[model samples]
Target: MPDNRERDRKDHYLPRGFLKGFIDPANKDLAKPLWHFDLETTAWSRESPGSIGWERGMYDYHPGTNVLEHPDEVFERFEREFPLVREYLLRRNFKGWVKQHKHFLLEFAQMMRARSPLFLQQQTAQNENTRIMTVTSVGPGNQVGVDTTVPYPPPARFIRNRTITAMREEIKKGPDWMENFHWCLRYTRSVADPFVTGTQPIVVEGRYPNSNDAPVLEDALNDHNTIIWFPLCWQACLVGAVDRFDEGTAEAPPSLISHVRGMFRRPSAGYVISPIKIESF
Candidate 1:
């Protein structure tokens, strides 16, 4: 059998199995008619979960060996437990949930943030610094001296490794801080305008745009003022608000869908994923 590193050459940041839930319910074809909209290009296309939202060896820490790092091992576990979350979303159950369940849900949301390309770029910029070296050469006697300077950028691998290390640390702490927040499972009454997700799926409402660093995210998670929205599937969305209570199984109004659809444009996401074809989100 192939080892973990070789199991998936194309690693999906957003779990492939999880995206399958967004497929159109009416489409009985095996093609899995999932709609993809490009926010930048204003173009749309049909796709399957396995064909999109993946990169070549994004999680392969080691290429020539069987060694797999924290991301692969950790993410695999989350995807495995996705079915349980799916069941929960399907039944719309709001009871019997323990702290661990809530914890994993929080961690999974953080992982989605960390795994995003934009987030990775932000983390890389935060971790890497340029090195400048200056050399002064003295000429014979009182001759003029020349100053030579060279700049060396940090290696891509070095920056990525450091970012990954920090990502591991942050992913662990994010969920813990936000565990006490009121979580609501909101569902759409119609599949016509199901919930939409994207490359940067987790939206931190009312927070500064592109301020998704660990410190900022942790602050948002801990702060009762910030609201977080996570699209679980076409029909369901997971919401976090510290002040709101008595939020049980409730119908997600069309106005709410319009609100989320409006959000996909801000900060400019790479892709907008949904069950129905959205002409212009």
Candidate 2:
């Protein structure tokens, strides 16, 4: 029988770099085992009626509880309520609409940012043993892509399109946009697969501690204390462990494909070391 000391040694025998960089010195007991999740950008599907028309106005009226007013009726109501405002909206195009609804638009964006982390916390509470670290993109791929056959709902559709485009542009210019932008992008996609195992997170390669995308990696490390970063292409998987504030580093673990190949080669193999829990992302 394996002794307690032997068991301890086997369990704690992670790569040296992984331990020094990721594991919190204060919590050397490995209180929460680190898990990684990947993010992917997907085009919007137009086939489903529920998926279409995600404008602010869509939530204002329910098909069951209220009659869906025609666009002209809605516009007439808006004009009646604020006659002077109608002229401004007509003259400035989308700029006037943005000015009028700036607060609501910002709030919508903020809500999108908050949803994922809250969901993740809820999931974690349900199962404390599994730590889910989500990875998403904040670069160019954050723009909306659609694959729909139905015609958009006129003015509402235009408003939604303009609002999203403006929001994306604003996010691109902001300093800490990546953190919030990624979540917002995911909310827009509204796909079932949370982990996005098939898609790879964007990797910005350069200098060790001072790369352009370093903050993004650092932020993830700080949040979860460890990350399993699977880059796209044929790049090796990176196991990042966080040691302290902005003091995390990564090590290349054996590729999953290679590990599987070795397993197939030796079916009678008693044991195989893996960098992460192989069951899920």
For this target, which candidate reaches the highest TM-score against the unseen true structure?
A: 1
TM-score for each predicted model, relative to the true structure:
0.78, 0.20
> What overall lDDT goes with each candidate model?
0.70, 0.27
Clashing pairs in 2: 21-241, 21-243, 22-241, 22-242
Report how far residue 151 has shifted in candidate 1, in Å.
12
* Tens-place lDDT digits, model 1, residues 191-211: 788888887788777555544
Off by over 4 Å in 2: 1-155, 174-197, 200-222, 225-232, 237-251, 255-281
Candidate 2 local Cα displacement, residue 199, angstroms: 3.9
Model 2, residue 137: distance off in Å is 42
State the weakest 10-residue window (summed lDDT) of model 2: 182-191
Q: After superposition, how far is residue 196 of candidate 2 from its true place, in Å?
A: 11
